[model samples]
Target chain A: MEKTGADGFDGFVTARWSALFHLARLLCGGDRHRAEDLLQEALVKLWFAWPKVADEAPEAYVRKIMGRAAARSARRRWWGERPVDRLPELAQTGDMSAAVAERSRLETALAQLTPRQRAAVVLRYYQDLSEKQVAAVLGVPVGTARSHASRGVARLRQILADVIDPVG
Target chain B: MDHFEQELARMMRDSQEYIPFASEQRERLREGVRARRRLRAATVAGGSVLLVAGLTAGLFLLPKGPAVDRPQGPLTRPGTSSSSSPAPSTSSPAVSPTQSHAPGTPTGTGTTGGSSPPSTFPSGSVDPTTFPPNPPATTATAPATSTVAQGTRTARPPVSSPPAGSHSSG
Candidate 1:
């Protein structure tokens, strides 16, 4: 008797699918498969609460879910002794070689930061939440959130120091 | 208002990527919901059957509904009530309310053998558990506003709308 999931919510999902996919893709460092999975998990949770989000801006709710998904993906692992949350091990596959190569470079750099760091950076930068709102989404103190943005940007600057030298 | 805040805002605008896939994903959300509904229906039906069986047995065995329900003169006589109560005493703890209500009884909660007087509770109101879930303590804390949203709960994690058709027996 619980209508937690929306009836015909998938229809709404179909309309927003492209935008949701891209949001996931950006947070995932443009990895298409992981982006699709993250987008699906988030939309599932959203669909479960579809009636509530129906009145609100669906895009913002989806974005919050996407941030949570991206944070979770950044915590996965691989082969033993050395910790490898960042996936340098996987083989690259795609038709566009140049774009794939650049995206790979960005993925590695983004992976170097912890999930929250990357989430803070991605949300504040790509998703464009104010620091206070970012804190609300991440469920951390504003001061702690501000530090994540600062340290995340600082880390990204160091990693991309060679290519985008505006920091130097 | 602040320079660093503005700078951070500017940095965000620099990296915005939008990738779209509209058709493939939404179909999965619908399937997940259908699976959940089937599970809930199975649970409710199973519980209803168990409840009906319990009431039928209670009606057959214990004919006098309660000590209070039927008047006392028939029971107060020597052997009449004692003869009827034998099987219930063997069945469960609550069967011997008559044996425990004897004059000059030392303890009140006859089965539990507690020092607390039976008179501590008014004639019918005995146990806290028998008291409705919201006792005086919670009765005050319960939603008091006349305009309180119907079935809709306040916005918080533990708060949620009462199930669509759920009516409180109270």
Candidate 2:
């Protein structure tokens, strides 16, 4: 229950090291360079906390820590508004282009979502967590998790609307 | 889930990329942990040395009260001359001046050699309040003296991690 020092930190590193890297990748928007830096910083924080929380799941706690860390490092907005991302046109409609467009769409859509909403989506979809599990992991109510996921998904659809239904 | 919902879920799955966590990254993390532990260990060791020195010094160096005013002590039999009990313990006080600085000034008597510089008061100087009749010295609160001495976190937490290949987090 009580983590003393090195033992707790080593246990934490063994448990969630991989998951933390993935989280950094997502939070850093596919920028593996920045993701690595962010993850190292996050791990350093976990090291600082290892003594007190050695027995707990390091991944879950670290995920919450990453949330706070990313928020702190987030690009500031102009009056609480992030400019909408301009979608790359679907030229030629080839599978390669379509895939690229879709990836961009997903990334841009995620960029549009609030940090919390993006986190909810990543935890739900990428981590394959159930709503309840996401809620518990994020330390939020299940309803709140569901709402973030729903709204995030809705916005993604809206962003893709023009690309898919060219006539509409 | 509706078709679109299912597709959206699949879309996130499709976007997922493998992140190869190199051995180097893990080493970096482990090293960071080791460094922090070392730092904490150094802090405790340093503090402990200071505490022992202070207690020893306070036992001997600072303004000790009248022999009759000697407070309770585990080191002494009750009602014995307090003078004999503390003087022996204080033999090692110089080893930890920082640790014993406050305890020396029990009740703010502020007579710690550390606090009052001999250079500040010329050899022949005497305060007007103390005139020809040197006033009887006052004692400080025992509780206050001890509190100042023990300011760091006293609670020690348990930390156990079995050797590698001995236990698993799974």
Q: TM-score of every model?
A: 0.50, 0.46
Indicate the worst ten consecutive residues by lDDT in candidate 2 chain A.
A72-81
Candidate 1: tens digits of C-alpha lDDT, residues B14-34:
333444443334455545546
Model 1, residue B124: what's the lDDT?
28
Off by over 4 Å in 2: A1-20, A42-58, A71-81, A88-101, A162-168, B34-170
lDDT tens per residue, model 2, B47-72: 99999999998989566556658776
lDDT of 2 at B9: 63
Q: Which tens-of-lDDT digit does each residue in A8-84 have in candidate 1?
A: 46456767776566557667655677777777767766765777887687778888887765666544762012335
- Look at candidate 2 and give me any clashing residue pairs: A3-A51, A4-B159, B53-B96, B54-B99, B54-B100, B56-B93, B57-B93, B106-B140, B107-B140
Which RMSD values do the candidates have, in order?
Answer: 28.8, 29.0
